[model samples]
Target: MPLLFLNEKSWGTACDPARAERAMADFVDAVRAAAAADGPGTALVSEVDVKALEIAEGYPVNKWIGVSPRHRVLWQRLRGLQGRSPVRSVFPTENAADHLEYRHDGEVVLGLGAAHFMDGIAVSLPVARQWQADSVALERGELVEDDDGTLDMRHDTVVVRHLSAEPHLDGHLEWIRKTRSEGVTTGPRIWDSRADLYPHLTFLPRVEGQLGSLNPHWVLSVRRALERLEEAVAAWDPATMAEPEWRTKVSPEGETRKRVCRFTDLDGETRTFDLHARFTPGAGRIHFRLVPEEHTIRLAHIGGKIRPDL
Candidate 1:
């Protein structure tokens, strides 16, 4: 039998007590209905321990039991567990193999443990694993990225970008969805590669504007690029700073333009770091002082779809 309830630690809007009590009332109604149909035959009714709550989150189920009409009336009149006072009690432990449906932000995200959801945002996951996995930890300033693309650096010191707002790193999917068919890659070109790339994070061009998320890996990669870029910019000489050609004359009509690299560092400092000098045609090579950390730092070269300076 399935149980309809909230996690012990799950709270919303700073866990308003009055609001939580009302929600618990509805939850009890839902629970009793589910329990009536699943009674005795199913173990799900007793599987959840609402008392196992974190005190810090404000909504302690043990204390809030009297708020729910169903639990309140039952406890007031002495129900099954009413005689049993609030104390450490033993309950049958669930099998490790038992599958549980855990959801957050209203969407059924795969994984284990209880979590909090609100305002279309999933906040925390209260997971206590028996087995340990390899872990790594370091200071916030210790982490760095290579240079290649634009990025938004938040307060996520040791961030798991893949598990968070991923689309922020994968560029604006909305823009792509709205303008999905604009073939900027190829039709007639004198270049050997395409400009339309997959490795991009879509951000509003303005300082204070709307934003979205993307594939997490894409964001991590962009952060790596930023690391290299920071190094590249630091190593730049003042004399060679103005040499980067932001424009190139391809023809009398069609000129080859370049992209500007932008970034917001962890300190909330925003900077436009120049990468490379010139894509001077017939210089025998695409010789620019661009961030030479690695090609993996590129947004235009995503999915191997775009190649530059051929």
Candidate 2:
């Protein structure tokens, strides 16, 4: 005999008292029909317990049952498992199985638990097992890439990118998406390698200028590049800060085009800090002075790259 386990939660909350009673009656009729169709020799098992009813009372009854007569009949027959202790009913043996389960979603409508035997196309345990396996694989980021080579970042990928305790990480990602969507092409790019540092920096629309005002579009690009620099600082890795692609170098004098602007450290010794720059197309240059510490990099100055002599 096959066992049908009704989800007590679904049964108790989905229908009102009157509807529940009617659903139960319809369920009995359906079981009887199923048994009759299977012939006289087959036996079916229907079991329900009191615990399910207790839990079902706390849930809202599924009102969709009343809207469709077919749904009401089917749901009642499938999930209507309310009764006293060890409620058992018998119908026909053709519905018998080694295992039984119901699906709230996806293909395999009803699953039967049992090994292969001398019977015609009986539902078996592996059907349900395979469904569960496929679901797990999908959840684990085993996504098939479309022809365009795009795939959603999985939960694990998001976790890895979430490096800071800052709350506006999603906002940064949204800004990047928006910038790309607008087709604004200005960059000596900064986020290529140090994306992990974006959350720690503030992206101002424009920085103070000494020469002439910076272009708004160019400022936006500079802001993004500086954000990448700030991210590298927050990561506190020298290799990341010193990467050749980041354009880290000594500030240069305009007349001589030579490095200058040396700083004196706390030890009374003069030390030169590397300045980072990103050349904006037709918009001159933007420069940054990095003030390094044990754990952070402070932005000493940010503005248009003016001549050191000036």
Candidate 3:
């Protein structure tokens, strides 16, 4: 699950108490929904103690939760193991990453539990620019991307304003899927690799035969390249969507590109699997044909570099 950090900086002072209470209510509801969607205790509040914070001009967030009738019930379910626990303070035990900040395009964003956005956590927008809290004002419906390119330029980070949004959920699920793909080396025999590991892939029989002949050292690379294809196909319809060059690239063009890129499909007809991902520049490759009609990628070859001059 993607980490949802408590945007403590979001709790600005000097606002109307009633409106702040309502906004905090909404934030609580959003957190509840996020926790419900991702699992219990998925939302983190703050390490500095929420008691000192106010949602509105007069109402402290902790006080509001205790006094508000609706929040009283919901907080009970999400508090976890203890009545004193208002919000999760520590990162989940399942998360192994040792870091909390990630740097992108020179601007540093805090509270990302891991290195990459795909596997790390999300911090609310307007996050302390340059480590100075209160530097950026938190506003509802504000696109931090416009301010710092946090959402627009990066794949990670979610805003508390809209916890149920598609992009946030998709990113979290993508992390889970990626984690599930991590242990490719311990998978079944080469013959079963296709069915066991590459469920999203439609392997040509010849490609399966080639799998057995591939260097064991190179198998991990093949798994990674194919995983990229699987992620692309699962995320969008290739027929209507543009190719994700970031994940898989057009097989390089050269004289050997024509002969090496063509392969026999399961139908016994020769077809071009022009889209390819390289595991190694000149040593390993995954040649694949995208079947837009079926919305899947068929692996034509899974070993050795195929180039223009070959």
Q: Which candidate ranks first by TM-score, i.e. highest?
A: 3
Top-lDDT candidate index? 3
TM-score of each: 0.24, 0.27, 0.40
Cα lDDT computed for each candidate against the true fold: 0.27, 0.33, 0.49
- Give the C-alpha miss distance for residue 7 in model 2, angstroms: 50
lDDT of 1 by residue, 51-145 (tens): 55432256566776655666567433323322111111211222211222333334443211211000011112112221011111111211121
Residue 173 deviation, candidate 2, in Å?
9.0
For model 1 the local lDDT of residue 211 reads: 9
Query: Where does candidate 3 clash, by residue pair?
Result: 16-57, 17-57, 254-308, 255-308, 256-308
| TM-score head-to-head 2 vs 3, winner | 3
Model 1, residue 68: distance off in Å is 8.9
Per-residue CA lDDT of model 2 for 1-310, tens digit only, reads: 2222222222444334455544444434534443333333323221333223321243323544454687567555534432222212321133322122222233222212111111111111111223111011111121222212354322221011110112212323443344334432223233222233344443222232321344433434455456555555566555455532342222333434325434444456554433445433222343434444343443323444444563
TM-score of 2: 0.27
What candidate 1 gets wrong by more than 4 Å, as runs, is: 1-13, 45-48, 54-56, 66-71, 74-310
How far out, in Å, is residue 117 in model 1? 20
Query: Model 1 TM-score?
Result: 0.24
